[model samples]
Target: MKLLKERIMRDGKCFEGGILKVDSFINHQMDPILMKSIAVEFVRRFASTDINKIITIEASGIAPAIMTGYLLELPVVFAKKKKPVTMENMLTTTVYSFTKNRNYDICVSKDFLRKGDHVLFIDDFLANGNAAKGIIDLVNQAGATLAGMGFIIEKAFQHGGEYLRNAGVRVESLAIIDSLDNCEIKIR
Candidate 1:
């Protein structure tokens, strides 16, 4: 987690509208080694949980979720933003992306996620937490138990993490940023 925080400080960019761009090493062009470490940390944090599957929303969350699932020996299921024609009887949820300033209908096939599954939701960033909330809604709709939620970076100022925790969900974030004011990122 220390390394991750350091990396964020070194390479992360602060933009207007409270955005922290980490594409250099995270969202866009990924760092395998760093991702591996993140996966390891997630696994370590949830080692005691009975995690049957890993769930993440498509685009950025895939990398860390797959890595964690691979390390945990579990199947990784990602919610697709665009529904394919082949996908039938899909479980769907609507999520609003704060950064994108829009809503997306994310779906996953019923075959991948099922009842009696202990799921761990993973994501690259937790801004408004709508994406993670949508994933949790899918898990709930499927009657799956949400074991926990993991994040590579969390914007503490947004209070999404607190919202989930207040709702009795176990949330873990590697790097928590307090603010992005004046083109500077402050870690909590």
Candidate 2:
């Protein structure tokens, strides 16, 4: 976690108030070594759980999720933000983005999940729980069990974590910030 905290302090930028941009490391251009370490830690954190598949959303979440899946030796599945017309036999879910402050849809193929499989959801941030809800919906539609939710950095000031935890979803975050102000990130 020290590595992540330090990386945030060094490279993260604040756009307005709540959004902390991590372009130098995690979100945009990823440090593969850092990502691998994070993925190893994720494996360590959820080693006991039976994780058959690693699921996440497109754009930002794909890198970490795929890395985690690689470390765990499991298959990785990502929800597509834009549904391709050529893609068939898929289950689609719509989720709102609290970061961009809009609604968008993400798609996943139906053939990925089995009724008894355990899925671990991964994402870069959990701001308002909209993305999490969409992934959870996909899990339900496939009749697969939700094993857990993993995040690299979370906005603790937001209610997303609380909402997901209250709903009986196990959420794990590597680094949680209690607050952010004047381009400064504070950890709880």
Candidate 3:
């Protein structure tokens, strides 16, 4: 976690609307070594549990989820941002993106998730927690058990982490930004 915090301080940028632009190493462009380290941490964090699968939203969360699945030796499933014509049997839910400033639907095939699965949700960032909530809904619809949720970065200034925790969701975040005041990203 210290390594992640140091990397964020070195490479992260603070944008408008409290956005921490970590695209250089996280969402957009990626650092495989860094991701692997993060994955190892996730594996350690959830090692005692019986995790059958890893679920994440599309685009940004894919990389971390894949690395986590590989390390955990579990299958990884992601929710698609757009439903394709080829896919008919799917479970869908709406998630609001604070960064994008819009609400959109995310979809996943019903076949991938089952009633008894212990799913661990992985993502690159956690701000509004809507996307995670939507993914949780998909798991709920399948009657699957949610083992926990993990994130590379969490905007603690926002209510995302607290909301999920209050709901009894086990949330693990490597770096939590408590504040972004004075053009500085403060972490806890």
Candidate 4:
């Protein structure tokens, strides 16, 4: 993940209030080569897990999740921020967005997620673990086993990674930010 760390240092923007904006390459305007490399790394990290499906929250998480799913040759399912009218038999949960500073009701159809399936969750960033918790809730409701979680960038200064790891969940992050203080990016 050294390449990712270097890219973050070069292109990532650090703002006050512990925000690291990686829109230039990671999120908003994606770099496909880097994304593929990240996906390859995730596949390598979770290769031994019993994963049958890949899950992620919509929008920002979609790119990395899809890339990972493609690399693993697994079906990817993303939870919709707003439940569509046609969605039925869906499992829903509330997740607080760290960047948007709002709560979102994320939902996914039970048809895609079901019992006896092991799943890997992938996302662009892990800030406070709210979205991860929400995915865990949905997976539990579906009786699906969470094989592991992968994140492109993890704010290690936050509690998300620690909380998930302490809870006995396998979490892998490509680039971990030690601190984003005074508009400086510190990678761990």
Q: What TM-score would every model get versus the actual structure?
A: 0.98, 0.95, 0.98, 0.97
State the C-alpha lDDT per candidate.
0.92, 0.88, 0.92, 0.92
After superposing candidate 1 on the true structure, give the runs of residues whose Cα lies further than 4 Å from its correct spot.
none
The local lDDT score (0 to 100) that residue 136 gets in candidate 2 is 90
Q: Residue by residue across 1-188, what tens digits does model 4's lDDT show? A: 99999999899988889988899998799999999999999999998898999999888888888999888789999999998987678899999877788898999999999999899999999889999999999999999999999999999988899999999999999999988888889888
Q: Which residue pairs does candidate 3 place in steric collision? A: none
Question: Candidate 4 — which residues are off by over 4 angstroms?
Answer: none
Query: Which candidate, 3 or 4, would have the higher lDDT against the true structure?
Result: 3
The residue-by-residue lDDT of candidate 3 on 1-188, one tens digit each, is: 99999999999999767878999999899999999999999999988888999999889899999999998788999899999899998999999877688999999998998899999999998888999899889999999999999999999888899999999999999999999887788989
Scored against the true structure, residue 162 in model 4 reaches a CA lDDT of: 97
The better-scoring model by lDDT among 2 and 4 is 4
Which TM-score value belongs to model 4? Answer: 0.97
Better of 2 and 3 by TM-score: 3
- Greater TM-score among 1 and 2 belongs to 1
